[model samples]
Target chain A: MFFFKLPFLNLLRHYGRTSLSLVSIILGVLVIILGRGTITGLRESVIRGEIDGMTGHVSVLPADYPTSGLLHPLDGLYSLPPAAEQWLHANAVAWTRRLFFAPRLVSGIDAIRVRAIAFDPATDADVFPRRDWRVEGRIPETAGDGVLLSRGIARTLSVQPGDMVVLETRTVAGAMNALQMPVAGIVSTGNPAIDSIILFLPLSAGEDLLRTDGAISHVSLLLGRRTDADAAAQQLQELLGEAVQTTTWEKEAAPGLEAQDLRQRFLDILVVALLVMAAAGIANTVLMAAYERIREVGTLRAMGLTRRGVAGLFMAEGFVMGLIGSLIGAMLGAWLTFKYSIEGIDMTALVEEMGSGEMFQDIPFSSMLYFGFSGRTILLAIAVGMIVATISSLYPAMIAARKEPADAVRS
Target chain B: MKICEVESVCKIYGRGAAEVRALDDVSLVFEPGEFTVISGPSGSGKTTLLNMVGCLDTPTSGRVVLEGKDVSTLGERALAHVRAKRIGFIFQSFNLVPVLSALENVETALHLARFSGNRRKTAAEMLDAVGLRDQMRRRPTQLSGGQQQRIAVARALVKHPGLVIADEPTANLDSKTGTQILDVMRQMNESFGVTFLFSTHDPRVMERARRIVSLHDGRIAEDRTREKPSAAGEVALTSDASNESNA
Candidate 1:
């Protein structure tokens, strides 16, 4: 107890200097918590966008379809085999048929290029409900020319829920086709890229406009358990043979996810840089303290304190400072993350103002971002802080301990 | 039995052209309950001899025996143990650990000695004995020089060491404060039967000591015992006669 008390009291002798070291430690730990949380939140957001807005847990596409193109391929439309359809009905939690293609919109004297997605009105909601979107009007239903237009696309075409427009596109059989449709709704999906150039229509309308007779571009399945997607995809591929290709959402989103992982690695390096800077500050402070207290070291030595005891005293000072700063930093970081997770950080205006919406087309970044907090991260930050502080202080502590009692007294 | 013995101790510093002999073939012995003052001019080796005897240092070539054990060649760790358990120290600046209160300063000595008893009570009692019972909680900066030295004396006596080495303990005090500090140390030495060794240029301290050893260069110029100055402040050094007086 005296050992601890002595070092604590010694540190108080120069409270200003001690507080400087403490502030550095706190800053380093804060960066660690907040940086890691931001990266984790980003990864979660991308996964949610893929599973909910684009791909279901498992998807079956035509064998020749290319996933890397900017526009969806309409040349490989296929009718599902009876055996594959039977297996999906028995093994899947829910399933839906969808068609994707690029179309040019003609409104007034303007013609704009955009992507269109067609959904089966009845089963699409069960398999992949886009609960994240906020729509001004109702979704398109069966047997009509009504369509849902993204807010950006509607603004570009100067159309509203009751407005009429013409969509011109190429059929799977390589024939040019055009259709007149009435807008049913304007949807804001929060992702600027999707809102800027997307339109949703009924599958029946899509088939009539494109001249496909009961054929779809793909079938997306929602599994009973998301973790069972890989196995189910394999089973579907075997049942369907070579006519269709089965894949999981993870495989389809790998490129974007890989980019996110690279960013995470950079964040990790920044965390280490911050911690090292803080540790350097601690080392400097401890070394300065040792130099200023040479007389005190002599006095303690003459009082019968051993060299090891002297070293331990300095290390204790570092330990106490590190512990206090790390605890406060971690708690404050957790609190901030929790608050932001609930309230969310809105970057919609920023993204729109920057006009970088197209950059998010492939990665699918939503404007509202939330942070992640974990107890394990907090504990690890604290441990790293203490270990860094103690190790940094070792050289200064040894320097103080090695002083000769008589020489130090005379000095 | 001798409380401490320095046998032909020699301390050398540097080498060749820069060689300096701090203490050369100096021999001395102290007995229990002796109050001795070692006085000399500047750089006369008074501190070096005191350090050797106090276990604060070791001579380049010599033997230092304390309480029937040779400690001259002991390692730093072992020497620290000898100092902690059986010796005490006082310095010119009081060296009271400015962060600690007067009582806590005394408690540190007991802590180093590994005293397992009630440390606070023992430290407080020592302060009380030194006539600072009301100032136990005041830090060193809060106390006067004389009071700080009294705290130092209390600290040195708290462990009940067999010998207390004071290196110019009164150098930083005024005449009045220095005399008061010397009076407190003398009382402790007499009451506890502990040997007191000091290095100083203060005439008042030398007047109060029963033995005076004067050093010149690195050798002792004189070793004599005398009765403490009388109330009239008169002292006559009488060679071996003071030994008979002690008998």
Candidate 2:
């Protein structure tokens, strides 16, 4: 015997107001979905760049080393302790050692002080993206006297592969040392910092130039997943004891994450503001409807509709309005995401045009970026819309409920 | 037994220099099955009296007893409960919900009254009683004024309320339609034995009422009763003492 019917007719009575509310909610949901999708895309790209083409999941350093930055003094070098070496072999998917120094690269009159990094070229390819580096002559072998230079450095020297170059740096004993080796290949990492001043060579060539036997700078461990970096770092610290220090990719990428965090906070504030505007708009419309139908409300009350019953009707109306608007919004958001996902945003050109900034140093800064989004984003938008609408309806519904039936219909 | 008792109730309006007594200590009792009208000129308090009797307003002084409960003694919630179970209303403007069809308008009352039955079937029957079965699916806007008022009457009587209050129920309709709608109300009263309290400025409505209470200056100026209400209204009043002589 239920006779209280749909309140949709009331909404239909005011087409302009209803459409306005719907459009507001649609835009709000679109903003939320797009913001979330862009952030997710950025995060994924950064993690892939850092773990695969640059820093491994975790890096090990000497406990006595107080700070982390480029070019630690040559006197502060430490070897991989036997126990930590064993731990790396047992737990890590791949591991590599680096012997690095800031050296003045010289080829005739053209010279620049560049960060020289030596690697075990045999296992180095397992932890970094070098298999795709274009080769003019040949890649460096474990026993070869060949060296790799970035495109920027080669341009600075006006040299190419098969050309001879001299690397000059001071040793641990304050002795100046130099080595002349043929350039093996010129690689483009698509990252400005790595491309500008990086030099790669065989691990033996670096040890020979430094005049140290079995003395390496640090060990880097590549885990199967980026998310495992923190846990692996913690475990390595315990295994290596107090004499060694461990750091994760997150600590290294703090600056970039901090910028991302600010963007996220700004988006949160924007979402709240949008919801408030939507609430105000809907509240105004419902209030007007209540006022316009005062006499009808009075008639219903006299015929026995309770105050609670009246309030319930308005609440249902609000819920339905939000449900419809958000649903359409979700669909629109999905369509937009699909469009951009197929045709990625040109981020490499964008980053290049803007020059290099301090933000997102860990990210590879590739040529194209596709959004990462799921159905969850759409569902969250709908849920947020419904909650906002229901809350907005409260005050107006209460006013309608508390109206005096006797005076409402008079005159 | 008395269906409604207005015990010396007073309703005042305005203040000081503009103070006016809308109703001043007026008392009246209505029996079951009585088709009564509170008649007066504009500002004569006929509507105010109807409001007091219907429990839509609280009297400034004294009390209104509906069925067995004193409305003044009840809280807003409890009074609403009484209104839900015992009262129904019709308006001069034919205040039907424009969004709803004629059947739905009648069903709304049954729903609110918590009538535990097939609401649609009962509402359809109620509309049929007012000769609106064919227009049961029409919204108020789609129906003629007479048809809408007939739907209003059906809505008021659908729940079989103890008292049906109508304020100027016929003022908006033409002479013919107003009489026809009144005839529907009169028939419902005689057949169901339910009480009806209506206010009107129309003499045609008064002619059909079994009891006429005239208000002037917030007071009961005249109270008249007819032994048997006539369906022919003014025609019976004019032709009359012998309209019964033929019988």
Give Cα-based local distance difference scores for all models.
Answer: 0.84, 0.78
| TM-score against truth, every candidate | 0.92, 0.86
Residue lDDT tens for model 2, B173-202? 988898889889888988888898888878
Which segments of model 1 are wrong by more than 4 Å?
Answer: A79-94, A126-129, A222-228, B227-247
RMSD for all candidates, in order, please: 3.1, 4.9
**Interface Cα RMSD of candidate 2:** 1.6
Q: Best candidate per lDDT, number?
A: 1
Weakest 10 consecutive residues of candidate 2 chain A by summed lDDT: A356-365
Model 2 / residue A391 / CA error / Å = 2.4
Write down the C-alpha DockQ for each prediction.
0.69, 0.58
Off by over 4 Å in 2: A1-5, A40-49, A63-72, A105-109, A125-214, A224-231, A238-243, A334-346, A357-380, B15-17, B234-247
Error of 2 at B56 (Å): 1.1
Q: Measured by TM-score, how close is model 2 to the native structure?
A: 0.86
Native contact fraction per model? 0.69, 0.69
User: What is candidate 1's CA lDDT for residue A395?
Assistant: 86
